[model samples]
Target: KRTSLSMGEIMTIDVFVERYKDMESILNDVLEGTGANKKSSNKEQELNSRISGLQKIVSDLEKEKEMIKRVDEARLT
Candidate 1:
């Protein structure tokens, strides 16, 4: 069992404060360092969506070109 200490055995307030300071620094580092991967993932998703839209547009344009080529060939023959 731990015995209660007299006034001389008490810890200073600065010790607890320093511990909290260390915790705050660690939290800041974790937040800053870990956040970049999430940002990169979001950017990648945005680019992929844009590329999918462009692909659909390209497909439609290709179909139109094929129809135009068929009509032009028929006229020439």
Candidate 2:
């Protein structure tokens, strides 16, 4: 199967950047409350570790977002 975005509907860099920004804010809220000192002491570190993993994923997405913007700019010619 094949699908394509018509020129009129193609997403530009702004869309990807805004998406990254939204994701960052949501992750920030989630991590702030789930960190290592917020609950049953025994599971605190474990839970924080999981949050750390999510942070890594967010970081990767940010990098990809930048790459996407660059690629789109290069295609403008």
Candidate 3:
């Protein structure tokens, strides 16, 4: 039981890190205009839209991580 719980925590942290990295990459691309030259304004808009969506996902993940931390603290206590 303890091992499974620890594994679950590790998995959650890994996923959170992955999503955070993805968000950072997307943000960098949007800010640096990387790969924007090949596409038109519409493509740029699409990229912007995707960035916005990813930002929201990242925000939610942060909230979830905080919640998990709190839960773990409560369990420890």
Query: What C-alpha lDDT do the candidate models reach, one value each?
Result: 0.51, 0.57, 0.68
Q: Is candidate 1 or candidate 2 better by TM-score?
A: 2
Residue 15's lDDT within candidate 3 is: 89
lDDT per residue (tens digit) for residues 1-77 in model 1: 43333333323323444454555455455555655667646655555555455455555545555565576567669
Highest TM-score among the candidates is held by which one? 3
Model 2: C-alpha RMSD to truth?
A: 5.6
| Residue 29 local lDDT, model 1 | 59
RMSD to the hidden true structure, all candidates: 33.4, 5.6, 4.6
Error of 2 at 12 (Å): 14
If scored against the real structure, what TM-score would every candidate get?
Answer: 0.45, 0.48, 0.60
What TM-score would candidate 1 get against the native?
Answer: 0.45
- Model 3 agreement with the true structure over 1-77: per-residue lDDT tens digits: 33123647757866876877687686667756855465546666676777777777777776766777677778879
